[model samples]
Target: MRSPDQRLTSEAKVTAQSMLLDPSNASTNPVENWRACFPEIIGRSPAMIAALETAAKVARSDSSVLIMGESGSGKELFASAIHRLSHRSPQPYIPLNCAAIPENLLESELFGHERGAFTGADKRRIGKFEAASKGTLFLDEIGDMPLALQSKLLRVLQDKKFAPLGGNDLKEADVRVIAATHMNLEAAVQRKSFREDLFYRLNVLPVFVPSLRERSEDIPQMLEHFTEITNSNHSAPSVSFFTDAAIRMLCKYSWPGNVRQLQNLVERMVVLKGGGAISIDDIPSDIIRSIEGQKEQAIVSTGADFQPNFQQASSAMPLAIGGRKQIAIPDQFGVLPEAGIDLTSFIEGLENGLILQALERTNNNRNQAAKLLGLNRTTLVERIKKRRLAVLNEPSKEL
Candidate 1:
């Protein structure tokens, strides 16, 4: 028999592993059950799935999630998904776009102001926190939020309370705040453009929504989806397939604007082409115009305008995606170093990498792992089979 000390040490290690891996330890994956949260969120890309999984994990706890991505990359969509999967799913999910609101009025908008609170004081109004009582309040484009307001937000997040703009009374807010931003808040903090305190508070959990061009494989599905929707309103033919030539044309473009851009293209195609089996000829003039250059003739590459080519020398070593490393893109790409370089085959590699990470962290909690990675449980399973991630079908009861 083993000594008591040895057994105790072994048990402790097992417990730690279980806690880190177990969904039961964290609470049921409410996000798994709440599918409506991502009503508009499209794509089954592994990168996106991994992001959703991380967001769901962050959601279970009351940690404030800082969503980072390029503008129009669907930061708010994931924010909404997190709220819908939280305990506060039944409550309101309020969105405040910091960039859109006037700096002076933001305070009154967040923390209700008393009548005569300001020159334009209307009446006693509830702030976003109060309005989101027991629910989630999403702060969109928080990086653009005024530096003056960041301090107040940090205070409220820390204290769970806020004072109306002109009122002395401190009101209690039971709201869960989830902040989103496109700017590099970390760089912002270093530059002192954003407050350090607020960054830490919001950075407790971070969710990323990858760009559309980042996962071009999802383009085919998204194209079919948009085409199907458009086919309903107007149609000469109820066809489903795109000509290989047309699909090739799409796959080549860089899609700089991401999914919204793709959606725009789809809408344009549907209206302009009058809906049917789309041949390359049926494609729009602007899209046609953009692809006419010799660079576009390659078809495999839409050129640097979309996913600018960059070469990374690190394919030999395993790059950790979920580990504690801050995202850093190589500088050689000549574009924003933050966006990373594109690879012809790296899309497949990314899929494998994300699936492996999700399984590693989730300890095979398909439901929890799926949420951590932002994958549909079914999709995760499909990928597991496709990539063969070696996960348990049933969630381990060890938790």
Candidate 2:
């Protein structure tokens, strides 16, 4: 049965995302297949495997663990693996997304209350702490937890006990703590946004998950796994895979959003293309833009990549603009200070800097530089444009 929240999003953009909740409903992907591809609990990367080994070592010990990583990076999986490998595997494993709970209700949710403790308490209940007694309680996205609750959580971790929202008595739980976050606690500490003592308590046994870009070598395997799972969900008789060309394009693109973005892309492609292959044409315009931008970046990287103040200019640039509005380019935006001085020399120097960068980008090849600069080779020669840029000081060569 669909929940009320699920029904509310029935016409939203993520209808298909919900459909993917039960891939086995369509086809049973051999657990071994996924395990073989992704292989490790978190991943097959060396750092991740080392993390697993460390987690296994600590699994038997009755100590709190903190799994840290960026969003979409698998932190809960590590928590579950820890619980499964532990002696308390027979008990329940409770996973809570702390950010999902409302601030007012968090106290009630974490610690059970008497039948008449609060207004919503129509009957007695077992809180997450009691429910996960003798097991693990995985707290996901703990960074967003309110400061007031942090004290209580710290108390729970320290004494393994907590009082219900409205009760005067205290309850004890044997649940092991496993907290996860995408936030930088050290920075939060400096900013006084996070409780220093709570941060220290949860800082034990920290496991940091590497970003996808750091281990891009694993992307191919991840994509293959996601594609197959998607195909299975679609009731496809055979496995779906990206074509070599499509895979090439995917490899070329920089995944800023990491694995989650890749998963979303694969799901979108499967729904829209309805085949075992994802073609370049099937890729969305933004994805194509990312790939093309990477290619252009490679060319620009040879010389004009930075051009000084590029990042500052980029920060100043708007995310969206009117189709007809020609927003100022980096050159126009990097003008001199507000001082009423001869801005001509500064502008000319900036132009020269850009020109030099363009020349170096083409490796002192005059014709290529001219084309890159949107000028004819003859025009460049007539102007005696400097072809010897610092990035490449070789003599100019014709196209």
Candidate 3:
């Protein structure tokens, strides 16, 4: 029998491992506890929190999960989180990108081949399904899976058994599947490119991850997190920080490529700036141009000529949008004092003021406010959410 000290040491090690790996030990808050399960997913926005909650609830079930999100929005990360939070976490978590493989070799890659299964099949090879038995298999870009493979995959999910190529024997598949897709599978099904049956089977538990722009409030935190991670990964002396002005400017960006693009930008900045305060001046010209382009469009939408230079703002400038009342410019307007006005900030402030006024006029009715602002309800709601305005009511309630 082992000594008491040895047994105690063993127990302590186990406890420590459990403490680090178990999500329950992370926090007292249920949402935070779930968030702890996904350490790599950085966001506290309501949309992200909702997604985490859904993922946490579904993680306990053995049903197949379908993660839907735009490319680079971290659909695969969500899949991994689901696997990690599942009973199959101790087992392997294999990921395969259906879009990355060729149609000829994709089947063999998913379901291994026996010796001489095909021209290149010289030896028996394990496939993702067999390799992930008793664990989780993440099929990324599953919408891109060929129709032929989709039928076979559906069969495996249904029968829990698959046969290898050139082999008569069937192997048991005790795998939990988590599929992710940026494509609209419903549309693909209508287009006859994707199997409708497979889509429904995998979509038993659907989790929609919000894009970066939908949760822009998380950008500052994400930026800081990315900066620290990049600094540590690159062995920088210290972590870099973005200036408040720089962060505000970045928050204005649409982030079309989402989290991946932000992560790449953080790495680029850490490498280029050598770990220091990153100001708006340090921001890439393309990013600035993108923001400027948006502002130019907003200006044009107001029936005003696009003014590239803020300093050249004409006095008594008339602004009209969708037959709205024209703003009466003051004589002192556009005249810069010793401290020149930040036109971008001024425009944003004006926009917010108008939105607030519209909401008030409509008695916090988002749809009516949107109509008053000459914007669609969806666009208005998005703006309100981005600005964190809690005054608006549900779009369903007109009054």
Best by lDDT: 3
Candidate 1, overall lDDT? 0.65
Give the range of the ten consecutive residues with the poorest summed lDDT in model 2: 313-322
lDDT of 2 by residue, 1-399 (tens): 111222222332122222233334322433322232222343566555555556655666767887765556677666776665566766878877888999887777788777888777888876889888887888887877899889989988988778776677877778888898766555355456789899889877666666564566667777788887788899755556788787777776556455777888898788677775677777788768755655553222121222122111121221111122222232213433122212332343345455655665666677887788888878765433222222233356663
RMSD values, in order shown: 17.4, 16.5, 13.2
Off by over 4 Å in 2: 1-42, 236-239, 298-399
Q: Flag the better candidate by TM-score, 2 or 3.
A: 3
Q: Which stretches of candidate 3 lie above 4 Å from their native place?
A: 1-30, 235-239, 298-399
Which pairs of residues collide in model 1?
Answer: 49-373, 49-374, 50-373, 52-374, 53-371, 53-372, 53-373, 53-374, 54-372, 254-306
* Per-structure clash totals for the candidates: 10, 0, 0
Point out the higher-scoring one by lDDT: 1 or 2.
1
Off by over 4 Å in 1: 1-40, 233-241, 284-399
Candidates in descending lDDT order: 3, 1, 2
- Alpha-carbon local distance difference test for all models: 0.65, 0.61, 0.72
Query: For candidate 3, what is the lDDT?
Result: 0.72
Total clashes in model 2, counting residue pairs 3 or more apart in sequence or in different chains: 0
